[model samples]
Target: MDFIPEALNKKPEVLLIYTQRMIRGRTFEMIENLGILTLAAQLNANGFEAKAYTGITTDAVKTIKNMKDRLFAVCFYCDFDNQSAVAAIISYLKKHYHFYVVLGGPQTLHMTEKDLGSFQADGILKGEGEETLLTWLNAKIRGEAVLVPGEIQPAQNADYIYLEDFSKYALPRNEDVLDYHERPLLSVITARGCPYRCAFCFEGGNSKNLRMRTAKDVLDEIEARLKRSQRPRYLFFCDDTFTTNPVRLRKILSGVKRLREKYDFVWFCEGHPGFLVKHLEFIREMIDSGMVRMQIGMESGVDDVLKAYGKQASPEDIKKVVEICYAAGLPQLTGNYIIGGAFETAETLATTTRKALELLDLAPGMLDLSTTFIMPLPGTQIYNQPEKFGIVLEDRECLTNLEDFPVNHTKELSLPEVCMGRSRFITAVSNKMKEQYEHGLITKERIQADFKLAFNYGIAAGYLKFIYGKNNLMVEYYKKLIDYQGLLKEWHELSEQEKNTWVIQRIPDFSLFDINTLSQLEIDILAGAGSDTIGETAEKLSLSAEKIGVLLKGLSDRYFVLFSPFI
Candidate 1:
């Protein structure tokens, strides 16, 4: 059952399951994912043979088997988008190979003890898996019993471990890292943790104290990546907050400005809206220096909800940041709003939605409304005071269902209402953003193709929803695809002559084929294989102007294989 060579017998073979979304259109592959890959490489370098499974590869079974029967299993349960898929895989793996499962990332780290029980995972790495996981793996390799941070109980006399520092590990190397295409954006982590204590966020609680690499460290990594490839289209800063410290961010930006003069590519990262406003000049400099997009977690429109979530900022802060971004000549700026919260009533939800729409009108930037369901995770105040907020964490399985349920409830809104309102808000905001992008309210100086891909997926999703009732498959089918920025490029780059319209025909090859409402003939016509005019399409579908309008709107939005209507 052992696969390691005799020379490496002392070193344990570890299987790190890196699950990714299956749908290609809906997912946006963030930079943080690279951290796990880097972690794997680090373990390999230390003598433990580590292999990663993205879960989308065709040979996933073989890949898992190659690493199976290893001394330990560390599953990097990173993205919450496909926890069910990961859960299924974990269940199957454990059933076959009784390996120790270690879970981390936003989803796993945030799991309620009950939810953790459901995951049936042996242990949970509470925060910052770098030091925690490395210590555990090292202990196991040496045949010392290992106990992870936050492990409730370990086998008798197990080796207990925790990381006192994160700086000891070098920034991960970017060479030979594969994306969906051979040329997917290079992801780099310059920093970790955020100063803000927003209640709605489960991701940033990993560290109370934020740490960042030196400007030289960041630039060195970028320079190494550039040496590997002449200028990949984008560099993603997967840090929780890249610009928390204006001076350091500016230093990185200044370094990038020099690089862009020669490389001429784009970069993006998340930020606090308040920070962006306070550092408007630096933001403008960053944009000019080729930082194309800045994402802000402006979680609520109502001032009360902002306070309730401990956001420590106002809607005015959101307004100021957006206005500054628009004025800074930044091509794209994205702001997030949480629809349901302690202060959110249906009426308040409406107010937040109204304020969001107004912000879009006033600021002239893209707007995105995040999931309303309040996700309660471990290490946060929300986990301990679930009763204070009417949130009960039933079990470890709750983490898998966070995207669907509100682990925490507010007096103002019921869970169902929050979910519904959130969906509606998402629809409204996406529609408004698409209109703004189409009307040229926001300029896309960088990653125009990526935006176009997102735009098309939105259109397709809208059309599908309009035609078929709003179903989970329809929603998940699109969300999964859009998140997979790397994988989409693989489907797209199959041939140079291949057009985007081919998705109408080719999408069936993937898992989403189950949700396709269009018949085989319709798919062929929609895919541009057969001659089907808009009128013919309308007639064949025999739907109302509303339905036809939805389809046309989606197609025009970038869903169809037709020319870019926005362009």
Candidate 2:
């Protein structure tokens, strides 16, 4: 809104609305809507005065009312959850405003003519919208007839926009939506489409061609981001498969490594198992270049389940990639699995659970796991023909809720059975973590960290109580985490030599001892007194030197603190 100039007599020609759904619980993690911004940039380049609204805010409505007769184009990029909001906005605009309403993005690809009629949109632009929208607008401006999808042209090939230089457009900043600590996390997209055609994925069916930006172009965008206000500390690459092309990946990593030295920041990305395994050396280079986390799509653990879903990787391939990432010093690796696919059965679910546990056992404290039920999104094979996969499509609305168990039931398994299988898998992984903690394979700190990660995801899915019992486990773990933080605070206040000693001794506990009751001399020694000798302190306190030495040794032994002469 601040970017729009009020002194101009003429009203803007276009208003782009980037609609986003209200994330039920995870409000702290909302990402900026970048698609609409890209469209705005394209329209501006073609001599159109285009302004963008992230959502249908009060300011947006006022701006539209003021320019009621002057506006020509109003475009909306909506997703599944936000379709209702977009419809309401479009209905209101049609009643009062004169501009043509255009609906685009993934949500529109599946909508039938009946659905489009409900919104009362003047035109429908499906698939990638930039080129279609621009061409339509140019024709309208020239007083020429403009044909849109659902009326004259097919939605699939409505002039998909693949920019040769993606960097020409300015990306979204969205600093207001971020939390205090999250201000530094910026999102950047290096590629447009995915190469793999996994049957369960909407991207595979929607993208006709895979395109990527040059590594130098991407690096230049990053450098520009660094110069902006509130400099970012992390870059989240929003690509579907960041490592799709190995040659480009290497050039990006090499450039990032050079830039990282000048501007200190880390990054997280999405990767595929096949690419990660084939390029271990590149993974290492990525780690060195501040790639701290990766989310890998290991859709299923059973080979049959994977093959049915058109996933090229096997269970063994997933395991190998996990092993390699852990060895490369990657701090966090998230293995994502989709249960209840076309070939999903009780047996396959069990195999998947076993594989998940095996991966957890492979790296006790490093790897993280996430499992979600498969949703038959529109344009995918499963959605078009449910009977071929032995599934019955009951309610299309259920597609909006992919985080939960599959709402539709397969011929081999009922709805209850599907829910049970998913619950069992989550419990099994959690129990395995508890078992490791009990056996001392992993510390309580590691268990707490893993649970925190799980809790965040559970909250997002609105299933925290269902997955982990009615807040009891969460409450108990939170108390333990608090206690650990208290101990860590005291540990951090110690001298460098004392801190080294604690690490060398595996972080011994001194919390049981009461510091308040100790004499001043005893407290000084414990606090690493600068120059006070044990003998002089003993003489000053009227205790024998032998007695003081024994006391010091006893304290060290009890706390597991090793005394190093080199310090």
Q: Quick one: best TM-score, which candidate?
A: 2
Tell me the tens digit of each residue's lDDT in model 2 across 1-567: 111333234434777776544433332234445677567766776677776665434444666677665667778776765677778888998886566777887776666657656778877776666667888777765668866533324333344334455665655444322122335566778888778888878888767668798888888878776766355366778887788988889899988888878875778798877777777677788888888678888877888767777777788888988888877766567777776667678887888888898998887666667777667777777877777766766665563453455667777788778888888888898788667644657543443444443432221211223332344434443434444553431222445444323321212233645567666655656555323444444555677755655665544433323332222
Q: After superposition, which runs of candidate 2 have C-alpha atoms over 4 Å from their true positions?
A: 1-15, 20-29, 44-74, 96-100, 110-116, 134-182, 397-402, 434-567
- Candidate models: Cα lDDT each: 0.57, 0.64
lDDT of 1 at 382: 61
TM-score of each: 0.67, 0.72
RMSD of each: 10.9, 7.6
Query: Model 2 reaches what TM-score against the true structure?
Result: 0.72
Among residues 3 or more apart in sequence or in different chains, the pairs in candidate 2 whose N, CA or C atoms overlap within 3 Å are none
Which candidate achieves the best lDDT against the true structure? Answer: 2
lDDT value for model 2:
0.64
